[model samples]
Target: MSRRPVHSVRSVTAAAAALAAVGALTAAATPASAHAPVHPRAARHVLLLSVDGLHQADLAWYIARHPHSALARLAGGGVEYTHARTTNPSDSFPGMVGQLTGGDPGTTGVYYDDTYSSALLPAGTTKCAGVKPGAEVDLTEDLDKNQDSLDAGQGLSGLPGSILQMTGNPTTLLDPAKLPVDPKTCRPVYPHSYLRVNTVFEVARTAGLRTAWSDKHAAYDILNGPSGKGIQDLFTPEINSKAVGYAAGADWTKDNAGTEQYDGYKVRAVLNEIDGYDHSRTHKVGTPAVFGMNFQSVSTAQKLPASDGLTGGYQAKGVPGPLLAKNLDFVDQQVGALLTELRTRHLADSTTVILSAKHGQSPTDPTALNRIDDGPLLDGLNAAWKAAHPGAGDLVAHAVDDDAMLIWLTDRSQAAADFAKAYLLARSGTGNGIDGKARPFTASGLQTLYAGTAAARYFHARPGDDRVPDLVGVTQYGVVYTGGKGKIAEHGGAHADDLDVPLVVSGAAAPHGVRVDSPVRTTQIAPTILRLLGLDPRSLDAVRIEHTRTLPAR
Candidate 1:
């Protein structure tokens, strides 16, 4: 069924890779050459799937052991980028944005799914930033994830663990007054408006190609872009709501398998769209030129705590163990189902399948879990800021952390002072500070580390752009800022464990299961999709700026 000629790079020596790079650079000079529309019998569609939190090592090990798994089956005739990595701050928001926009957070204006934005809340809104109407705060999925009680308001379908133990009065983040604001435009931001870059969907739609996508939350509407155009059919059922109160539905109640049920519904949604109909959308249909969905099943297992006969979370390095293995199998089944649908419709040869993930989970070594309390840190920063500006009403607006902490400060100009005060108190104190009294903070050389490397590439922003974080605290490996007792493993860091995501591109004009070791970024997926759809990759502004190139094509 393969139509593209094969080119292998599995054993590419350094010299060979260098030559390929030069070739790629030379070829990329004229990206517009690929704009010819597909012939009548040519592949006209691209299927992109992101299994959130699925690490490359996890996939490699899974494929090797479960030779018959869906990933292995696809790898048989696909181009596997073993060295594919996501952009820094590899949270779902920035990672997915990077894939579809060919830009990092610095370029796309997206930092995390839940981040502080200085833009005014959406029009016709009155709440957010506490009493300060124009302040920056979180506008994440959790805001609208769960509100109504399930089964006649008699359920608990939100927030992991018993919502009873939440600190800082988190319910306030979801309050109508604490809405998210887009700093760039100073408009109250919705999901789509939050995205600062054009997505492949918008590009494809502008070029007259149909597109469809499915993700866990409306926050993913960022993939649709600020204009919110391009997507012919979009399905977002709200996973947090579906998994509210951890209700184990009949379909997927095996340990962490409940997430599979949520993912399964979306997979079915994509399949239905691919079959030329979207009951949720209009009737103008055929297979989309670009279609995809993200699965959170494995992510559920990756964050699962070990308790009550549960051996979940990252088991060893390569071994997914029983819990994760089940989710992996479920993902495989969904992919196989998608493939079967394509074949039955005689569209297999007319479609390109790209199997990948948004980001990888970190702290695979469970023994080194370092849970830090963020309360003291936030309080210290707030005190410092308040002391500097008297009655500033908490200069630290909000703080989000995975293994790394992304803190949003109210006064951007005083960032240095804020950092200095917090650092001094943290260093002199004990407790969580070191002595356990919730010391000011840890001396992780956050500024030093952030400055020593690709700081400009990741943190560079325009002047007066409140979108940039005021202070960033990247905790040491395995050190999460929250002392929360739910998830054992988290992501959002520059660590190899979090950046290394699995990427497999197959079908249509793709090579036959060739292994590519040359370093590639998740950003390549956008340009690659444009190329696959017979569009000039250069048409994308971010791609043009980055001089991005598609993977090898013969």
Candidate 2:
């Protein structure tokens, strides 16, 4: 859908005034009053915790099995959305963006980890390569100037210059200057690039709230990368302090090696930040209001070979499944430790803790599993179709996730769409292609899926959008796209298993042990947080589903 033009402040004010005159508006548009002191000693902090790949069932099972689990305890003290779910075609990048921006793929325009679009460039650029290239330097200055410039041309079409250039280009490697230097090695370390969003930390900082984050993935660490321009003062593990990791070739498979060890060590860093009592001197009291952390060891464990078994030779009857469960328990222990630290610091009651997964993993269909031995069926189809339609330029066919494939033909000529449709149709079956769910649709079907209903709007008529997939092939449940060797499980599809995730909020202000069963999207998290903080939720596009009147009034 075409983005509604950003209205000028003058125009917005005038419209609001007109609406007020007709009694169509109230104080809703005005900024909420500063939160009044509930008790003389109420807590005013927020802690958002992210459990990588933690599924809804996982939490429910954990809580059911172990009533003393940190999550269960939190739920007893607050609320848990039993029926919480994410948006369609769920993936890590889009899910996180949905939470942070309070917008879905249609609004945020971030569909996958790698959403390629040739329209990101000017008219002269030929190739639709990955992220634009540049040094991973701070763009705060440029962004500030761009915001000002856009404010002047509030009604202009297209994004502002800074956002256009930033989004259009691929991300550059992290700058050595911004990274921490290792005293022993005298060099920088860590995977220091690959984030593309202005996250919550930045927003809190601009609002004069002190913020800290601890995360596991490269995307989370690279908050100050191109995506995290406005953030200031983030405390993390010393190992991730560098722009790259130590060159000793740390093995990821070893039980206590590589990132696993690093992650364990990193928890202390977050603990230090949380435990620091003299917030006035260290994080600045009253401003030290937001803190978040991510635990990714469980996600890493999922990636290990199924045959490896659990750590310390604890080989149960099952293969990776046993190991996965054990690892989840370990992660739960870590969370428990963090909660303990919060209580020790007297921050648990005041803090609003949000526990969720970036995305969920689908177990490999035990019935059909293999490894990468031959070309994927989609690849073969693309090759044959390309040959048939010689006029179609270098076609872009990408497998975004285990059950989804997106194809973008360079040439929008007549032959391209016809060839793709025929090729896709020919390969529809359980093993032949996308497990009989590969129904080829015209652009109209694509629009319908995106817009939800005929009344929905359509966007993406921009220059750099030519790279959007012309046809998307979806797989049914228990079906995943694989090479010669198939995977037992995968994600990145429209299936319910991959899209649904837990949404639990716990704290002093929340309702105790309440389970909400309404279907809610991940996009609602940001707006929900803003609402809890007594901020204007209108800026976001998310639909507020739950009635939050039970929350302590501001």
Candidate 3:
């Protein structure tokens, strides 16, 4: 990481106690928005946040219910885009990268937590890296499925370097043993490889801005590039590393915080990073270029697996249950703490705090919760195709099912493609059906869900890119295809419940209490961050491709 001299000139606004006392600021382009004020010096620091699974409706309900929360305070100082939405496959990986890089999964080459890659695993076989179609390098926290390879030589024993950074050198961050390698190609795929574009952090860093970010796992390591190294301080503690909270143990509450244990851990990590120190305060660094963290307690409570904390029923039917509500309150308190920290560090006016969700959970309505298994149907589809072709390989190479299903087909033949599309459409008919049986799959009635979506428009760079999902199926809202234990609500759909999320940008330059009804996508977030810092948003690959606009400021 590059470092400036300790005596480097600091932005007056960053050190100022209030915004009114601050002088005029300037940005890359003069404020071009027909609705924005005259040229103002750009915000100096950015505190981007990803409150995973926070629905637009949920935020409104939360504000309405808890009139005096920090969320309200932040919104009071900024404009919240009521119509902001995550990208198509509204799952965590794609969603986060969508905000960070302004690209859909197709552009990022990432679809879900566990996606199939055409790349083969490394030469030597490892239990974590399966030697097959290859899995997208995502951290689910569990050893088998997560970023165990980036475990700073500690594996699962202690915190992974991806989060804490035990080593001072940022270049050699990950341990080779922890890297995910392709079996056939014998190529080890580092986490950053997942993202196909440079993030705003990288763009900011290249322009001499210090960058930092934290999320649930090191898999977010994707935010690391546009360059070899950008983030000044990166923290990503595995949410699944601890089994006490959600595990059937003595009690998580007894250990201080229940259910919210993971979030609490990240809260501490984020605060530490914000203060320019590592977890242990071993070394001190500068303020930050673009720093942010994600909150998961609310999402965890809403989507708690059956075994986590569900004593009676779902977290809540129409409104949040006690547990979910408490978690929201906890996050709000955390937000307050974050704001206080910013002010304490004299960074209040200069730092833009972006609050939004990576994805939104489904089945917020109990009556809407419905879980279905597409495994049997998918297996049958494979069996039928296998029987017909004999040695043509399985029709379905890999499949990740959320509210939407990303299906990868092994048989790319025209006939097989036609059959698969027909099969999914047949199964996705009225009420989601196959033949005469009702197939509870996808919110969109047709399997051609991707056909008319931006996924097709943007994600499909060229014809038959192996990285592109061959077929996509969206289950009705509240419908899930997997029977994972303890799991309740799920996301990844085109429905409003999964797509619409909060996008609030608040700071000295922001118009207080204003709301932007202008339609915007989460993709605009990266560009907005750049614009906030007086950097050109079009400098980014995806932003240049998407023509993402910056948020309007008064």
* TM-scores, one per candidate: 0.80, 0.66, 0.80
* Per-residue lDDT of 230 in model 2: 30
CA lDDT for candidate 1: 0.64
lDDT ranking from best to worst? 1, 3, 2
The candidate that achieves the highest lDDT relative to the unseen native structure: 1
For candidate 1, which ten residues in a row score worst on lDDT? 163-172
lDDT of 2 by residue, 1-554 (tens): 21223423233234333212112112134332222211122236666666655677767766787798776887677656655556444666567656665555554445655444433332122333542421122211121212222222222344221211121011122233433233334343222222333444444554555655554333334444333543343433222222123334323333323445545544554565567522112443332465666665555555444424443211221233565666667777777887898888887777677777667655433433222211345566557866876765344433343555444445444455556655555452334222322333232112122211111122222323433345554544444455433234456556555665778777745656655554445655664555455444443323222211111111
Which portions of model 2 miss their true places by more than 4 Å? 1-43, 121-199, 217-228, 234-262, 277-287, 303-308, 311-320, 368-374, 397-399, 412-415, 428-468, 484-487, 539-554
Off by over 4 Å in 1: 1-42, 119-134, 137-139, 143-187, 242-255, 279-284, 307-309, 385-392, 414-458
Pick the winner on lDDT between candidates 1 and 2: 1
Evaluated against the true structure, the overall lDDT of model 2 is: 0.46
Give per-residue CA lDDT, model 3, range 1-554, as digits (tens).
Answer: 01112321323233222222222122233322211222244687888888888877777878987777889888877777777789878888888888888777767766777666555443234653444544444334432233323332344444322335433232344444545565644555666765678777777766777766666665566677645476766766545443442336332222214436656656666677678775435667766768878887767677654323433124445577665666677789989998998899888987889999988877677565555666766877787777877776778877777677777666545566667766665553223211123444433333334432323444555456556666766665667555433455678876777787898888856767766554567877876776666666666677655555555432
lDDT of 1 by residue, 1-554 (tens): 00123233544343133223113221144444234442122348999999988988988888888898778978777777777888778788888888898887777878877766554554335433443434444445555434331111223345333222222112222334335554344445556666766788887887788788887554455677878675766665555553543444521222465577667767766777678866233453777888888888787787776422556766565567567776678788899999988889898887889888888887676654556656766677667666876666776665677777676655555545355445533442322321123333346323233321123234666544656665555556665555656566778876777788988877886657577766677888887787666566676767876676666532
